[model samples]
Target: VGHLAVQIARARGAYVVATVSPGKLDFLRELGADEVIDYTKGDFTDKVRDIDLVLDPMGGDHAQRSLKVLRRGGVLVSLLDVGDNTRTQAGARDIRVERMSVVPDREGLVELARLIDANKLAVHVAKSFPLDQAGAAHAFLATKPIGKVVLSL
Candidate 1:
């Protein structure tokens, strides 16, 4: 999802900055990230500032500190969880906070397909698992791959 977001943001002419672990720094740059920050070395919020949008997956600490980086009207989206503490800050900062629950949207799917066909987007299936071994798929997911682990049913 982060990879897709990076591509989409860059395609729309946004300067994409990714905060990644050390191992992913080069890979993210190869995918056209304008700047890559090694998140393990220092706090990303301390390093990044005046940002427009943040797509946060690890919502606990990241969702809390990320407000500091926003340039007044910037928004932070939490994909996993949203706590009341985070909500209060968003109101205080006067910036929008969205808790996104990804559901099927026909228009979005059509646009994604168009982007894929136009070679503006690529989906990386890191590993494939059979439908019967759903438990194995879940185990593989425990490894925390940056790319998709697809189920080939």
Candidate 2:
């Protein structure tokens, strides 16, 4: 989900600093990420600072660290738990942490379709396997393939 957001941001000509899993470096580049950071190699804190926006989906400690990197008056939107109470109490204004679970509306979908039709966006389908091979799909996902994994109907 975060990866998709990065792609959309890049399509809009924004500089995207994407945090991708290992082995997805080439894929991130293909999606036009300005900088791709492998979180396993080093702490993101050492590299990013005073960021204007931080999008967090995997919460817990990541959300806490994101607050540190966010510049004052910046916004942090998390798709997980609303973080600790202290985070909101602090100076992290415009911090919106809520569980987002829904598809886009018709208007939003229309725009998305237009973007795809214009070649401004690319959706990478890693592979399609049989439904019986669900375990295989999970295994392949554990290897961190960029984009999506779909089960053949």
Please state the error at residue 103 of candidate 1 in Å. Answer: 2.6
Q: lDDT of all predictions, in order shown?
A: 0.85, 0.76
Q: Which residue ranges in model 1 land beyond 4 Å of their true spot?
A: none
TM-score (all chains, Cα) for each model: 0.91, 0.84
State which candidate has the highest TM-score.
1
Lowest lDDT sum, 10 consecutive residues, model 1, at 117-126
User: Candidate 2: deviation at residue 123, Å?
Assistant: 1.5
The deviation in Å at residue 150 for candidate 2 is 0.4
